[model samples]
Target chain A: MALADARALVPHLPAFPHDPAGDGAMLMRAVEACERYTPMVAPDGEDALVLDLTGCFEGQGWTRETIARDALAHLARMGLGGRAAHGPTPDAALALARFGMDELADLPVAALALGAEADLALRRAGLRTIGALAARPRAPLAARFGRELPVRLARLLGEEDRRITPHRPAGAIRAERRFAEPLASVAPLLDVIEGLAQRLESVLARRGEGGRRFDVALFRTDGHVARLAVACGRPLRDPPAIRRLFSERLESLSDPLDPGFGYDMARMAVPLAERLENEQRDLACGEGGEAQPDLAPLLDRLAVRFGPDRIRRFHPRDEHLPEYAARPVPPESGPAAWPRPEPGEPPLRPLFLYDPPRPVGVVAEVPDGPPRRFVWRGKHHRVVRHEGPERIAYPWWKHPEGRGPTRDYYRVEDEMGQRFWLFRHGLYASESDHPQWYLHGLFA
Target chain B: MTDSPILRLGSRALSAPVPKGRGVIGLDVPEVDRWLKGGLRRDGLHEFYAPSGSPPGPAMALALLAGMRNCGQGRSLMWLRARGGRRKDGPHAPGLAELGIDPAALLLLELADPADLLVAGVESLRHGGAGAVVLELRGRCRALDLTASRRLALAAERSGTMALIVRGDARPVPSAAHTRWQVSAAPSRALPANAPGHPVFDLQLLRQRGGAEGLHVQLEWNREQAVFRTPIYGDPPAVPAGRAEDRRARRAA
Candidate 1:
């Protein structure tokens, strides 16, 4: 019924505007809460969550009914009202729960999720209930109504099965702990994390594998999930080192972890793992000059405290443009193999390079020749000896509009012996009337 | 011979030899090494400052070369600096490669502030895996005080990694450094085409812990041989214009 008619009949009914985005956010939170039961939880529509409880039943040693009942109670504690059901496929269960009915046969044809016109056409054809549609021959029903109708009908009847893509990929190795009472202190949190790490270590050692990345999910009592993730330089399985990394990560957080209303459970999972072989350690210090201490632990500690991006290794790229020739890569990619320079060539590149190249006032002997004198940063320099203009043409094929102007670069040394790399932006006569000069880099 | 009776000391004590901690990595320039008492100390803290209103490239390059000498082979070279020191385009990798520094063993850390940079520097120095650690600081850093320098010195001594601090336009302060030097760029020899040759550095030893200080030397870097040579002087300046005109005439013919 329209709100106007309802308001006229029963006066003073509070009305608010419809908000689809707000409703979707609330549904996503419900999906996150349902993940405590199984990692394979997906939000069905704007109202319901679908969880594939396949092995969870056997793992927890609980019947399907008890699990569904416990899920509903858990949602209720989080101030959400919902209905739960069990079926062979996720689609059947979602339809049963959304309609708030136990029997699938009594569900209306709207559960097929066809457009409004198709729904009206199906009802007008005297098929108002799914039971009537399922009883008829699927060939004629698809021929008359639509091809999608039979597929939907089959799913509702639990005749076809398709898995739901979960919100998070289920980890191969994981451990979880639940507190009897709400744990409010930070001391016991580390202990709980340590216990979980120990459990995960034994499983990883048995398989001769170690984890490269570990994720910790802390479920607070007030329906909030706080997550922490850390990656190591090398594959690691020792529990104490893992605990220390977590402690360092916690100590460096800007907004410290707050156990609002305490935490209900903590779950630790290894998302990425690699193979690690056990090796015998040397009895004495390593022989010769190769006895270097392990640097991975120190790098890992600093990376956790200060972000990994801050610690980097140089990676060179093969490009003609100076700016795109090199980049700083994060340390986890390991050291990059840089191409060696020619043995006899003098240092052609500069140690420090400026971006957008600092513009300078230049006075050259000829317009198309090398620079004679230039002023930069309020200091004037006379170029005694200079090299030819090494022409580096910009990649014209990369652009769609037209070809970019050619650049004339020169390696000029000032009277002070400080060398500079300068380039003319464009050809003087062909590209523009007046070309600009820029200081690109400085050589030691 | 005819000495006072009260002055009874051994001749070995009279020599007064300076204690060289760990060892020294020579630069191979006979003149500078003689003043350095065998090149720079391997397990010591050394500071480098740029000249007045000049760029820090010369100072930075000098530190890296000395650090590489201490590193030798198979060990890593780490550069630690505070944020805002680099432009959009970072340090050129090819230039370092031309200088014979292996890119695979180079590690860089740009911290949030000066304090964090020092902390990370100390941490890196504590590890023996680091063959050389270069700490680059710009401007006047109040965080790097005497105590922090002392801490870095102690850690470097314990781990046997050479530490080089490059201060750009920053005044020299009292610290536990074993030697301090001021580095500036000097002219290079003209190559065949009258272009600039290799890099040349003019270094002034401002202070040494237990040795003579006011020594000045000019050294030119030879990339092929991976060594420094005293620049050869006493020749007229080459006229680059004449060389260029001659090449043009030959091409036209």
Candidate 2:
């Protein structure tokens, strides 16, 4: 027990300081690397990892034993030793892998990961193996050893189940391919993507559905993963279109995909799916048959290159304020019908409106009459003709900041034939004695 | 006044694909028709340049766009722009409706990068699903040089989709556009002392592919008839000529 005796027993022993942070970070890298197997890999503890292989391994024609063996081999290559086991539940598998093979009956109850004090108490009671503890009467054990004893015993025997949360959400459908030799070029990778898309298309077709989003993940030989995803405006099952979208998506990536080493495996998954019904096309009328043109393709390409937010259509909002009357919504939203104008009538509003009303100096004859002259952008303009003093009151309940008397809007034409939409912010008597005028919009 | 809709269109007709082809839409004015060599060809790019310190280019662009929309039936329009341009605010729907353009038939894309806007505009032209594609770019976009303009022009020609690029407060740059015009607001014909009339524009033909250049025209938009007209034939004065001056002189007296 002396330091000299221990050193003499193992004279070549290496020692280093404890590094919990380094160990934790290494464990996280291992977890990320293991995602090549399944997206649902999670770090169980400091030394363990949990993978939910519910429906994934079966698709590859691999049994649970092979999956475990492959996982252990993978970690071994990473310079870390690991033990893996498959059970009916995560708790059961964890207990078995740490203790021994199916010989769970002979292992000590301490293998259940119970706290040290409880384990020592069970040992003092002459309960050596899990079998001895499980053989005891349920009621007496609960009363004497505590409630956790029976629960732990049941879980170890695969009677009770425990849930494990995956680090990443599992996709609805997935297809993958592993190559004997790693691929380095984009052409072959794109071919693989096409094949995977076809596979996904069949899967979607069988389910009478379509995929709205597709994610392609490449697994490098050096344990790195690069993922690219594309979204469609409508439910899509076409392989070529899906491939084209992926190509566009790959080009649009800010950080280009780099195969540091080489990619060993590639996978495609449909994370979001929607129901789509097939429709017939009119050949005679051809492209002109549809009343509203199909702009979805154009919209999708633009959205992928730029962003969905950059491309949009206007929708009517239920607001009284001029600025709030309309809002930009996604292109998928149906646009509201514009009000039609009667023949021989001047425009109701200006073609372009200033987002934030620009302030302008005004000179008026009467207290509440329309502006006779105005100064905009340090330029003077004489109002030759004026249309209205249309009063638009503020919705006090909605906007407390705009809680004032009604705004008087006038459509006026200056001497230069330039028309403007200007409004007085408040009234003379109620809100403010001297109201301010704002240049709001311009006429066509 | 003519009973035949075809007669109303006069001898100049749009390039017809079929014998009854409605391919090219005209501005219905013989002067502009002769100037444009049969109105604006549907299969090309039109550039409208509003010079610096002017407010009329945007208005003229809208009027021309309204006229272009009249050519195609049930055809939608797409307008693309950069986010931080001079007029970042989008077109008001009510205003567009008053110009005879259904806002429902329009798609507006506001992008941060001018390059993306140009690319998207060209791509939209290629699709030809929309009747026309309009790009509102202010100042100079390095990405939209002569080469990009030519590419867009070719795409529009190939697809038969009318393309219009409206540059605000920017001088004419080297472009391969089919036609280029400089537009500025001009005072309307003297009306009654205080009455307003139709909008008037002083339009100068800066460049045209195979047509005469250096031609100037004073144009007015007839809101009631929804047509473009030369100012030579003016409508009855809304207000008596010099009425405002007469009133001012009277007040002075």
Candidate 3:
């Protein structure tokens, strides 16, 4: 049979059950594996992959025909049947795969085309062989079949006149499943999310890539779409990390995802990916050298429960006053380093520092030293050993609310071993009749 | 003949065999190690009490990591269980690396759930060929019973690893292990001519297996080298008997 006759049988092929697209994924994987042999490869529709082995063939000391035979053998091992032809262009190889006059000529014309349109074209032309099609004038055939036919024909003849463009694979993989039943509660949805995340992770692992952002789509029974997306500060493959990120976004979902009938389906996709290398650190010595505690996960959970905007870290501002020294910032948007206190500063710093220092009343204040006695939390306590009057002045440009005040912080040890970090808010200037004292944090 | 009897008594006292080989170095004060049979046992859980208002938690944890880095070949993994609570408020990664630990070898597992933290701890202990496991919890871990501790101990023993538990203040004692220490900030020392100031800590040996008990050691942390060293103490002034009495009373009060 001639090549054109075989090429014409493509449209009329009957669909095979359980062979949708004739194992496209398997074929792609096999082709990708072959890329180590040569970088240039193109898919011939659904069933075949074409490799440009011109430069590679010489290095292997094999003729083009011999290399084609080895490629077919490798495909056979992968349970795929294919025919290869060495042509100058990708389009030519594809055409040759369809209708080359090789030993594969015994395969039916319908098998080569793989569908019905080719069969109809062959019948209309009354062409039985590729030789017959080659006999026709190029101009008429181009007019009758449009531009693709002659271009494809020229490629098959090893003419380098036409260029073949290969399709690029998707940068990231995505899969979606529409449920027959809508999910109403959090439990079932969590199960689906877990499964989806696992599948996405496996795909990424195979590609040697990790995802930093993922999007989950919830298609409701009422035809509404609810999409959630989460981003990680770093690329991660650990399922727990992915789950935690998703949980945060899920909690903040605004339009109550009511499963009217239920969510029809959930689709998970990796929109962005990055290559990540594993990290390693040296171990500490002694019992103290054991693992240190990580607070990120807890912060993530808290940010999910409370809105992300509500949670913040106290960053010590580069200022003198205790109240002006610290600012609240979103958990995600800050440097990892916590600001250090200056030398000769007050000894005591509170572990749990409040945003705005709460006010208290002080009975006696000595210049250049801590308060002698103070009323805090509705009680009186005498300072035994007091340090400081570490004076902190405000930034003149960015005045705090209800400011016009400078603070003198003191590290006062109570009768007990317990210590208190207190500061007088206003200066001793007579212009301000009332000076306020505030309690900031407690020292361990 | 009387001298011979005295020599025999002296030999017996020396032969009682002081326990001092097990406590973790660079962590327990010399006196605390004397009580702990050495330092913290090489393969057991050492719990720390971190009250909300305590500075000792971060200080002790940093000291522990520094010690482990000194002893072990590779990086250490720290499993933090609470958010915002386990801030590496002091001694960030770079600071730790300068202290002879490879920062690249440190693996920080910041997990949200306590169950996940436990699982990671077990898995890391089992597979992570690192030297130690540190768990920072909000309160006492009632969940970590004797059985769990034994399992963790067995894992550590098999891997020749160590586990440190830093529990928040108010947590009741969970399970007994090799050593337990409580830490508190001592007092700050004056800065030198132009150097950054050092943080001073009074590490009290609350519990130990064999060494001295109720011992206090003062340490000054050098920020630049990321190392800790004993500070020089001034000479003790001679006091009048009445003044001495007053000093004792004030201390007791």
Candidate 4:
């Protein structure tokens, strides 16, 4: 019935517009609560979550039914009403729980969920229950109501099984702690993190490896998970060092962590780890021994506080174009080297390069000549001395029909002794009607 | 002593008269090293400003100085630049390599907020592992007050690393800097074909904490030699390249 007709019939019916998007988002968040059970928790259309709890029931002595019961209990605590069921396959379990059917054989033919038309056709053919649909031959059923009717029947009847694609990949090494009395403040988080880090160190030490990146998750009672991550310059296994880095991260958060109503659980995972060899410390002559201070700690501290992208190092590339010649990367991540300059010559390149080289009005030889004078930013500079037309051709292979025009570069010095690297964009008549001049860089 | 800025009491040059405990290094110029009392103090803070109207000279000078602190010491150098410069492109790597500084070893710290530039500068200064720290504040930095400079100087003193700050479009302000200099471009000596020669700078010692100021000098940079020297004037006329030999004969007559 239309909402207007229903309103007229009832006179006063409190109603709201259907919001599928909001409902979908809320369902996904509610599904996150199942991640505490297993990482292989996946949301199955509109209102259900399918969990693949393979190998999760060992040692704890809890069966699959008990796990589902616990999940439903947690959902109830979060103010969400849900149904729990166990089946041989994800489809069977979803159909069973959604239809509130205890026995699979008693489920209606509509439980196959092959669409309303297929359901109506099957009901007209006297197949009103899933048992009746299963009793019929699959070839006739496929021929009658398309090929998907039989497959949906098989999956809904626990004959076909496939794994669920997990919402998140489980970490290789992780530690979690649950408290009976939820922690109400953020003061002891570092201590808790240090304790977790110590647990992770033993496993890493045995494997002869260390963690380079760590992620911590705080599970709140209100179903909100707060996550923090930090990366290190080197593979680190020391608990105190890891704690220190996290302390810096915690202090620099734009919005401080809020343990709304308290956090009930905390977990730490080493998402990325690398091999690290043992080191020997020399007790004697420790001061000024090699005279090199360890800079990794300080760099990691700064990187955490300000951010990794803020600290960068230049990596020069082998390219014909000046703009692509160099790039900045995170600190110490580049090949630390540079080519030696040509001897017995003034520096050809300017100290600073202007991107989209600034345009200038110039007066020079008509055919092809070095600029005699040029006006840049409305200021005139008379070129007292200059070196030519170091012609650089554009990279032809980079374009389909051949791209940009050749540039004629010049290193010119103005009367004030200021040096500039400018260029003519193209040849006078062949490439363009009139070539344009541009200032590329400034020389100190 | 004469009233001229650089006092040549005798022909022989004197070593910098530094205090008993402190160490100093030279820029390979005798007059400049002497005028600077000893030379730049190892654990000190120095400031370099671009001349009022000039734009490009001081940055290159500071890069050359940073190269001095980078090479032969086996220690990496840290350079901090704020992200809010008016210019689009950053320091050209090939240009830095041409000026004798290794682009790879120079760690570039780009701060998103100009306010964080000083904090990063002071942190890098206190790290003690770096050979030197160069802070590039392109314009007037309101955060770098006397107190902040003092904090940077103290950090530099604690760790034996040097601090150099380069300002692009800024006026001289009161700070805790040991030596302050102004740098601007001068005419380069012409080469064989009237081409611009090595970079020459007209530098002035604007102020020194405990020494003299207003000492002006024209110095040229030699990248291969990794030193600064008195600029040499070329004999060839800056122009008349095409009528060269005939003009020389006429001038000789």
At residue A431, what lDDT does model 2 achieve? 83
- Model 1 achieves a DockQ score of 0.43
Question: Which prediction has the highest DockQ against the true structure?
Answer: 4
DockQ of each: 0.43, 0.36, 0.05, 0.48
- Candidates in order, TM-scores: namely 0.81, 0.85, 0.47, 0.84
lDDT at residue B18 of model 3 (Cα atoms): 47
Q: Which tens-of-lDDT digit does each residue in B15-132 have in candidate 3?
A: 4544545434434334333334445566666666654444333434443543364335433444445344443232133223223334334445555556556655665565435467
- lDDT string for model 1 (A110-173, tens) is 9888889999999999999899898999999999888999998888898988879998888999
Global Cα lDDT for candidate 1: 0.82
Q: Report backbone clashes per prediction.
A: 0, 3, 69, 2
Instruction: Give the lDDT of residue A161 in candidate 4.
Output: 81
Candidate with better TM-score, 2 vs 4: 2
Error of model 2, residue A398, in angstroms = 4.1
Give lDDT tens digits, candidate 1, residues B66-163. 89887765677889887774556446677788767777778888888989889889988987788889999888899999999999989889889999
Model 3 CAPRI quality: incorrect
TM-score leaderboard ranking: 2, 4, 1, 3
The candidate maximizing TM-score is 2
TM-score, candidate number 2: 0.85
Q: In angstroms, how far off is A380's CA in candidate 2?
A: 3.9
Query: What is the C-alpha lDDT profile of model 2 across A49-163, one tens digit per residue?
Result: 8887877766576778888887777677678887887777777778778775677777778877778998888889898888897777888988987888788888878888877
Q: After the best TM-score superposition of candidate 3, give how far the Cα of residue A367 lies from its true spot, in angstroms.
A: 7.1
